[model samples]
Target: MSMAQRERQQLVEAMTAAGPEAPTLCGAWTVRDLAAHLVVRERRPDASPGIMLKPFAGYLDGVQTKTARKPFPELLEEVRTGPPWWSPLRPVDAIVNLTEMFVHHEDIRRGTPGWEPRELPAADENALWSFARRMGRRAYRRSPVTVVLATPDGKRAVVHSKPSGEVILTGKPSELLLHAFGRDEVRLETTGDPESVRAVLSLDRSV
Candidate 1:
């Protein structure tokens, strides 16, 4: 099976095991709310646009609220099976869901105390690195300090324009992905001027 598919299945399993009221890294969202968001993202494209667009934010919230009110088992089942074949998400499933599911899986796992990074396949690591390289700049565009993301083996991508000083963030690509997406709990090393390092480390905004 594809890595994305595996990640999705694992996320569904984790959410099911965590139960509905469990906390998630997503601010103020419980496990049930997170599951509903995923379901709406995949199965309800008509309501998904509001998720990222400010004007439609209320609509997205309403859709998620309605979906979250469903039986937890039924919501979990829909997320596990994924969007219907005719859904718009199918065409970009790999590009969209791979990282999305992986991150949210970690959100549930790592939000609790005692969580650790998973040992992902090498191929998945490379895939995530490639995707992060393409997406990192936009993710860090608003940073006050310039950001550079590097892998242990020397792959590197620079995000944001050069400033008076910059911070280099190095770690496994998956960890870097988490950091890029504003998960402050991710393990990463930063090197640069003290102020620049502090600025980079303090950032926790989503892309």
Candidate 2:
């Protein structure tokens, strides 16, 4: 199966094991809420715009609240089966969801105590690195200092640029992906001026 598909399935499995009330890295969202958000994003495209658009947020929340009331098993089933064939998301599932699923999967795992980063295949790491590079700037745009993301093998991308100071973040591509997406608890090394490092690290609030 494709990496994105595999990640989705793994997330479903994790959610199933964690049950509905488990806490997630997504603010106050429980596992059920997260599942509802995932399903509504793909299944209810009419409501998806509200996810990132402030004006439509209440509508999106209403849909999510309704979806979250469904039997947890049904929510898991919908997530595992994915969006309908006619859904717009189906055509670009991998491109859009590779990072989304991976990040949310980690959200559930990391939210639980005693969790560790799972080793991913090289192909998956490469895909994540590419995605991070593509999305890094927008993800890190609010930072006060410039942000540079680097992989262990030396590949690097300038996520944000500023005049005063810069911070270099180094780790495996997957870990770097997690860091870029605001999972600051991931194991990573930082370098650059002490002030810059502090500024970058302090900007851990997720986008």
Candidate 3:
């Protein structure tokens, strides 16, 4: 299988083993919900509907919104069908997907309250960095700040947000990416402020 496929495969293996009680990032979604979300979302965008957009009480969620999950077997069918939109075949989308995986893994890891952080694939990690470096400078992310990523393993990247100000952030690049991707509860040292980092991450998910 290709690197991207392998990465997704690894994610499936790790998450499938998580018990129903295991927490996923989407606020109260068990690991099962997370798997289902990934699987259902990977299908044509048309698969979901207005029910996804309806308002509700506690835990109201969009169909393919960030934290939904599905059965492990269902995700396997998506694999047999094809890759999700955010995948290597789409290059940029691949990075986007990696960011999702990394962040969501934290969701599961933290929700469980005592599990270890699952190590992401090196290539996926690198792809996310490359994409972040580029996307950070787009008209959308334009800010006068320098975002530095220092991963636990020492992977590093320096991205400057121009025209805003010189802001600096440093941490395990993956950790930063996860925090930036809205997994929540990720702690990182900041030269500017986490609010700024939080803004960037929010945009990454929303836009």
Q: Supply the TM-score for candidate 3.
A: 0.59
Tens digit of per-residue lDDT, candidate 2, span 1-207: 788899999999999999999999888999999999999999998889998899999999999999999999999999999989999889888778888899999999999889888988888888888877766787778878888999888898998898878888898888888877778668899999888788777775466
Question: What is the model-wide C-alpha lDDT for candidate 2?
Answer: 0.88
Clashes of 3: 15
Local accuracy of candidate 1 as per-residue lDDT tens digits, 1-207 = 777889999998999889999999998999999999999998888889988898998999999999999999999999988879999778778777888999999999998998888888788899899777666777777678778889988998887766577888899999988877878878888889898888777765585
Backbone clashes in model 2, listed as residue pairs: none
Task: Write the residue-wise lDDT of candidate 3 on 61-90 in tens digits.
Answer: 454443345445665456444455564334
Candidate No. with top lDDT:
2
Give the Å error, residue 179, model 2.
1.9
